[model samples]
Target: MELIVDATPTATVIRVMATRIDAPTALQFKEDMRAITAGFDGRIILDLANVEFIDSSGLGAVVASMKQLRPDQSLELAALQPIVEKVFRLTRMDTIFAIHASADHACAAGNT
Candidate 1:
């Protein structure tokens, strides 16, 4: 699980460099997210533009990531592929987190 971290004035954008976030990479994805988001105190946007697939474990990992965040910090998602977006929608996880069209759009929305 290769996650690229980009810090902006408003949020930290972590881009999923891998194409899939399934059972095999789920643990590593959560671990990496913990390490990368350790000190961040603002909103964190996960850019999933490159991710084409996400299984149940992957979805669990994403939810776990949000659970591990500080109370003041938040985890949002952006640029999800249609398939991935469907998973979130079908699972009703879409209502749990704020989903943006893109990382830039999330950033533009500010801390709201």
Candidate 2:
């Protein structure tokens, strides 16, 4: 997983440029997030622009990261490909994680 971090006024944006987010690399992705935002407070906006696929384990890892964020921190997802959006909607996870049209939109929504 190749993740690039950007600071937004409302959240930390992470653009993931990976073909697939399956079992093999989910853990590393999660660990990378943990390491990158160690002392930060606010929200996480996962920009999934380049991710074409995600399995159950990948979804689980995302949820786990949200859980790790703590009592007040927020985790949101953005720019999901149609296939990935379907996965979240099919699993009823769309209602759980806030979805946005873009990373900037995600950060803006989280700010409010």
Candidate 3:
């Protein structure tokens, strides 16, 4: 699993390059998110376009990452693969966090 973080003026985008965000890669994903948001106050957009699968731990890690962000900051998610989207909906988290169809949409949310 590879986690690449990119920051925009309005949001920090974290892209996960992995087939699955399961137990094995969840911890690293959480840590990478922490490191990326350490000194930033902008909104967060986690891009999951490359993630094909996600397990319970993986879902938990994503939630944990959101919680880890500074209280002043906000967290959003974008570009979720179909299977992963199903998980979020099934877990009823689709309503908990802002979900966007694309990164552009996510970023635009902060703009307006």
Q: TM-scores, in order shown?
A: 0.97, 0.91, 0.93
Report the C-alpha lDDT of model 1 over 33-104, residue by residue, as the tens digit.
999999688899999999999999999999999999999999999999999999999999999999999999
lDDT of 2 by residue, 13-47 (tens): 88888878889999998898777766567788889
Q: What lDDT score belongs to each candidate, Candidate 1 first? A: 0.96, 0.86, 0.87
Colliding residue pairs in candidate 1: none
Can you write out model 3's per-residue Cα lDDT over 31-73, one digit (the tens) per residue? 8778877877868888999889999999999999989877888
Error (Å) of candidate 2 at residue 79 is 0.2
Instruction: List the RMSD of every prediction in angstroms.
Output: 1.0, 1.4, 1.1
Q: How does candidate 3 score on lDDT? A: 0.87
The weakest ten consecutive residues by lDDT in model 2 span: 33-42
- Assess the local accuracy of residue 75 in candidate 2 as a C-alpha lDDT between 0 and 100: 85
TM-score of 3: 0.93
Candidate 3 residue-wise lDDT at 71: 80
Candidate 2 residue pairs in backbone clash? none
- Quickly count the clashes in candidate 2: 0
